[model samples]
Target chain A: MPIYGVALLAGCTLVGLFVGDLIGAAMGLEANVGGVGIAMLLLLALTNLPGRDVGPASPSGAGVQFWSLMYIPIIVAMAAKQNVAAAVSGGAMAITAGTLAVLAGFALVPLLSHLARGGGQRGERRDD
Target chain B: MIDVARFADANGLLVAFVFVGLVMLVSAVLARQVGRGRVHASAIAIALGLVLAWAAGVDTGGKNGVADYPLLAGVGVLGGAMFRDFAIVATAFGARVTDLRAAGLAGALSILIGVVLSFAAGAAVAIGFGVTDPAEIATIGAGAATYIVGPVTGASLGVSSSIISLSIAAGLVKAVLVMVATPLIARRIGLDNPASAMVYGGLMGTTSGVTGGLAATDPKLVPYGAMTSTFYTGLGCLMAPSVLYLVVKALV
Candidate 1:
């Protein structure tokens, strides 16, 4: 049953890669763009379709759920693939970019939270 | 006994899985006992993985890290772009459209704003550092979006592996900071309710960090935050390579 999920994922990945390649070509780039992201969107759309019985309780859904939870292992594999030594030796650019991004995220949290409250109030008022 | 090295080489993928599993097991324990459950096990595992990879790179004098060894050659395939993409795409099944709707307009906007702002921050830093290449800048910017997004964008852009690794490192640093800082600043940020948690998750955009932080702040809010953070990663992945990359190219 999990194999079925893997099969579905494979199909989605293939189609996603093809489309991504096409988009890249259209953009005049030589690389595939967002293939994995596209495949994910397809999977999300398909699994969440109305009247779909493939919720996490079902067999095929279980297969999908299994891999979803297995993100840790997969990520671990991905992490192992990194050459941190080389990345560090490359320069301080990586650290600077990473630190600034996080600091920026933290700095804007209050602004975003304020925006969310405004939107929430508007939604609540509309509902009433 | 019977050519164990040869056997490991023959079943490289399985061996790699087993090796990573062992590392994860240790990481899980460290996260609990040492990190006090504040840090997610995956974070610890990633740090360990990086250390091991660096050590392997130093020892083997190979660019591929541990995979440079014949016995661990399967690590290359397992951690290659194909399997990485497969695993990432599979995570989509966990999200439901209904959940996204539940987060409301604010939640949706947060994801959009979060991804763009994060990208901008990363790109600004890249530019400040004298990196002029658009693809490299975009890849690093995407890394600011999330670790997953960084590598995905990098691979899509066909950037160098070192740049991809840097993006990943950037993401890891962000994740760790979010995890550590969330609880400390929860009260100041009014992060008590489900609504605020969702917004915070969207803003943070790291699933593990948001979930772990919310769990530490208030276990009841984990799911709400994690849900939006999931969408954040998804949105970042979609936008970083194509839209964000183009924007960076035009600007630079």
Candidate 2:
């Protein structure tokens, strides 16, 4: 059971975007797919800490089960004003956003590996 | 015999909860097998649940909104499981993979391709719809986001950010930050970088409020980080409108 898996997802995704936007603006760039792609990779790395030994293969569903149940309320709210058709219509972009985000993520895994190599050449500095 | 539409309209959330609970219960019952049977059953159960919900006239395609509650609950649970799996994969990789230098180059190219795809898709949609005002569309998106996440977005991103642009921009930047910040944070928190990056990236992607990976990666910081990040993102989502507005003003 990861202590902070769901607990941190909401805030980081939203704020990460804001920060990303600010950075993008600074660079005179708005978000294209690539920018969003990097952000997805960033998200994958950010969640690693609180997520230790808390997967199905590990044989414990207590932690995630609780959070998953808690999401009922949020989902209730999500469906409170719409239905499947509505979600697909109103949320088509969001769904698109989610799907695209994952694709961006897959592409990022390898790219980040390359970037890490460059960062290493600077020095044998292990912050960890 | 079952008039699902009527039931949902009257007790949508409760109805949804009951349905999801039943599905979980069924999955649990199926687990008394050869062990491996449970894993396959779990996935099958999830798919069945989605199918049942859709067929039972869940009304996710209607205007009442209350009908879709069941779907959300189910999806949420599944999403958590999938995310948990991704975390484990990252952890394993970090323990094994040492050469992060190469990962960064791959990161840039991948993100570039993703961004182009998003633009093409968005442009095609905009052109098809005959919608000329990008700002107006962004504003509408901000409002919709406000409805879902709430006023929390205001405090986090500001009151004038654009929803379309903000979401696209944030989603990607967080992706890049995964590589830049994960290792440093992993070290600070005493975890491996790859593990840190994968888990942290997922957290920030879903939550969107944590700063460095310190809160997410550290064992001791998990509880505090979880609480803080939860409150902030929920609050930020609520305030999304104000934040989006500010972003738009500042950027434009």
Off by over 4 Å in 2: A1-69, A72-77, A87-95, A105-128, B1-16, B23-62, B65-204, B207-240, B249-252
Candidate 1 chain B worst ten-residue window by lDDT: B86-95
Model 1 lDDT per residue over A29-121, tens place: 887876777888888887777886777788887777777777778777777867766887744776676667666766666666666667455
Candidate 2 chain A lowest-lDDT run of ten: A31-40
User: Can you give the TM-score per candidate against the true fold?
Assistant: 0.93, 0.36
lDDT of each: 0.82, 0.35
DockQ of each: 0.61, 0.10
Docking class of 2: incorrect
Per-residue CA lDDT of model 2 for A23-63, tens digit only, reads 54774544311122222334445533354554423333333
